[model samples]
Target: MPEGLPLSHAQEALWFLHQLAPDSSAHNTGVAVVIRSAIDLPALHRATDELARRHDLLRSTFAEADGRPVRLVGPDGLAGLEVLDRPGVSDAALRAAVEAALAEPFPLRERGAFRTVLVRRGPQDAVLLIASHHIASDATSHLVLLRDLLRSYEPAAAGGDPTLPPLPGTFDDHVGAERGFLASPRGAETELHWRRVCAGAAPAELPADRPRSAGTPFVGDVCRVEVDPEAAARLRAVAAESGVTEFAYLLGVFQGLLYRSTRQADFLIGCPTTTRLSSKTREVVGNFTNTLVLRANLARGSTFRAAAVSAAEQLRAGVAGIRYPFPLLASRVRLSGGAPLCRLTFNMLNATGSDPLLGLLLDTEHEDRVVPNAGLLLSSLPLPQLGGELDLMVNVRRSADALAVEFRYNANVFERETMRRLAGHFARAIAVAVAGPDSRIATARLWDTAEPARS
Candidate 1:
């Protein structure tokens, strides 16, 4: 190990949790890129080594300083690679192997926090697992890593150069730049902005199915729904008519769903925003994500269009301060008991179209079609929930002609059917709201089972 840079704000928060649950892999973010074609082991090994060398953070581990966390970037080499043969195994077994690879905990204080496991079912079928501690990676970072890893593998397979052009700077550069900003007057303004956003905000405690526990089990269960394509198109038309982004309208609809279901007039939800405000940081890999909390007051008789417009405005303002670190914001608010500032988190990827990272990688594929082409399906392993910091998480992705929404809830707090019904309410609410922005939010229909006592 060599001397290294300070951890980014996002990194520090996750590192704190990592320290608290050193045995849990709930914080692990794993990406499995399925390759239906044969894999070149030696070439992949070479590419793996190159990728770790390229992103300093990928080869880094954490340690505690006097009172804070620091990242120790390791010298370049093969980070970690494990190859397993799974010939003739059932699909269940193959899936289990992939999940195990992802759930395996990292030796954060001693070894690099990133590793790759290749589970080969046949010469033409295998799954490539890229697992990294959340502290060292994010959705965007994984995309960068996947793109670079595939690119590196292509040429190495052909015995061509695997070396990538050096990045303008490392993750340390980003940490330094962000720290400088926080120490300036601008940082004070950022804090004030958050103060205004969070004042009088109550945590989103949507009536849970079970008693609230002192310690959140973080056990997660998922419920999925696919927005009817025709309905999605209608909503898109509404957004266009209102001159607001589709995401703005969808977010408003989500808020409306919560309001109609829980009968709460005011509450908060959050969406993760990338902190990479500069092109230079785009290619750098690290935990550069911040959660942006938006407070919504669903006044009686408020039209969906008005809500959409309000949401769009708040979204713009919230993103403007995306550079503000979430951990610091949590502290400034003086929230205690390790309860997350916001209980419901929503993220919309593919807002423009396909996944941003996949879009970038697809473009690269056009230039170099010779890479070991493989069909990649990104999925989350159905492993036991490591535990959750939040009560609910909703992820929305736009597909060919519809929006797919997945609701992940704390199993201890929410029954699987509870989440399932919530998903139904969301889909129905969006469909009804799309009829026109003037549609009353209360008109969104739901079963009596989910209706709440008026708040």
Candidate 2:
């Protein structure tokens, strides 16, 4: 057992946020799966126990050692599962139970950072809820955990050896690599690159419908933005013609939206980038995500195509410097009023060819076999509201045929109608830009009425 293990740079940033608001469940990352089949209770229990044994992060807690946060990995065989068999639970009741479980905060110094709850509704129906603090997991980790759980349950239920293959690497190994990188010459170069990129960039602030005061709690609400298949196809065609990926083109569109709404020519937007640079750490269940501050500079009288090309260039540069930690950059690059540098962020979760990690884990072969082996049918359940940390987070999920854009905004800062208007304007901007790629951004129609365009 390792002793006095330091938290990774990402974990340290989460720890600081946890300290600021200890009771907030905003940092929880989780997934819920509905099962429509008879389950083996004992086997599933054993599977959950095995999951804790396989990953040390599932049995870990945080504490202060000499005025610094350190991870304390506990012994194996920690049963993190809670089984609740309700014979006559309604759909609303089941949803309420899952929400309560997800909203429960973890006392970092006392209990483990993982939670598993099995709410059995009937003989052939159940919902499995798994959640962990962001310090211990990421979006990809949820898929990894689900994969391992099903792998362990199959053998345990059949009265055979339930042993699994050893992990490629541990989370501690990732931490060691990060520490070493920060001390290397490459790390210095990465930091210098970020310093220059963020030297004169102003904080990107969206116009809020309500007044924001100090010490507002981080409560949030989500609104859906619908994009038809035709629009999606047109957007993709425009992206290819512009010589940029769909992500870059969409990011440029978002920047154009901000420019039209707020008229900020130069600002920063937060972009989350993956840090699983090697196969060794790819399968490791930990926080392997880093935020990259992408600068969007729209010169006066520039076209939408020019904005996208600039975005592609800046995105290429930003990803190159992703090794520099956000918290460290926050300390070094001082902004006025102590505001967060990247207040508005853009994220894309594409079903095809966007996220390789998720695509690999939830591939057709694995997805087909996992549930049916237990005589189960996967059910669609509403995703849990795992709160937000930014004023506005625009997530674009691309499927095979259409794009689903969701805007998650702080309820304390903006109203629901405001988000709806923003979404409408976003759709309009895309249509205008793709229709006339050479038109001046200032001439793009944002509202129904015609006004004198700025030069």
Candidate 3:
């Protein structure tokens, strides 16, 4: 085997974050599935080992080489499958067990970044849990791993060969390409574009119910709300009429909420962008996410339409400069000590129509199969509770006729009731913005009465 490979820029940032909070499980990415059929344990184990062998990042550990972090791949890529039998266990107990397993920390320096557990509830019922450190996996990676795991399991279960497709490129090749880009003229231009875009932007100061104290832990909870079919349809229609993507329209509404709450005309909101530019890396399992700090400038007399248009423009510019490293941009802006460059993030996931993961779990096509030829019904388990690293994170999942919105916030910085109210405010903002796109952002109603007082 060859020597260790250098960590990518995204991996390096996650490595430092892990060092800062070694016990924090906020950076762990996980997914679970409830299998309605008796699983072949030995076959599943073999499939898992095959998955690790195929993806080097799954079998790799992070360590410092000459004061810089490097990925060291082991010879055997086995992340042993641990099976637990709990016959007649209550639903609450089963959930608790799965949560505990998901929250288990990974000693990335000594062990591989992947883990798996099987909780057998009965002869024909079980749950499969998969987790990996964010340094080695991401949202897209979870889907890739699941597809490959099941693809490998079917053959192993039948005592036949698993003919998986050849990987187009390895994680090491990605790292090399990233390094090459950073040294190229295009990379320099991209960095310059970001620097100019983020100039004079301050971290958003969302009015929290409680003030954050020094050394406060990064604990968080999620509050979810659903937009009615009528409202969701109106929102899509408005976005289409205004010649902007749904993401831009949603982001505009979020920016308006922040502006009304903080009364700040200019601030920053982080948006995660994928760094998988080439088709070769489409299925690669690693951290290929980069944060793009979108500057939301709501002028004094701007209307919601103007805000949405501005958001659309910024999104275009940001995606064009997505190749610029986030860590380098952070350092260039001297955003070291006080507060993070962006205190809020907004993400939009098209779940109902496009996302392959949700499509598989929900069987959106009514195909009656998660994995072809596998006679098992699979449903996605709720994601395990974990800490958050942001002041506020908003995620919107678009379905056929409705939009499901979830706000994940730091519990220490916000009360449950505050988050509830915030969720309501978000819904109202969307309704108002879509109903009257030209309404002045300042005059848009967020509360029945005056806004709540900031702490």
Highest lDDT scorer: 3
Backbone-clash count (model 2): 0
TM-score of each: 0.91, 0.92, 0.93
Candidate 2 weakest ten by summed lDDT = 362-371
lDDT of 3 at 70: 86
Query: Model 3 scores what on Cα lDDT?
Result: 0.81
Best by the TM-score measure: 3
Predict model 1's lDDT versus the native.
Answer: 0.76
lDDT (C-alpha) at residue 233 in model 1: 78
Q: 1 or 3: which has the higher lDDT?
A: 3
Predicted structure 1, TM vs. truth: 0.91
- Cα RMSD of all models vs. native, in order, equals 4.0, 3.4, 2.8
Model 2 spans with C-alpha error above 4 angstroms: 353-375, 450-455
- Cα lDDT of model 2 by residue, 380-434, tens digit: 4555456556888888877676677888889888989889878877777777778
Local error of candidate 3 at 14, Å? Answer: 1.5
Clashes of each: 2, 0, 0
lDDT of 1 by residue, 1-455 (tens): 34556887777777877777788777877666556676778888888888988888767767876677787766776375679899979978998988888888888987757888889988877778778887787777877887888778879988898888899867788889889989989988998998888877766668878887764546777788887777887877899898799889989888887887677778878887888888888998887878898888888788888888888998999988887887889877954345567988887756345454464332311222223342233222333333348888887877545587878788888899889978987887777778767887866454454565433
TM-score, cand. 3 = 0.93
Over 4 Å off in model 1, which ranges? 1-3, 335-339, 351-387, 448-455
- Worst ten in a row by lDDT for model 1: 361-370
Please give the distance, in angstroms, between residue 420's alpha carbon in candidate 2 and its true position after superposition: 1.3
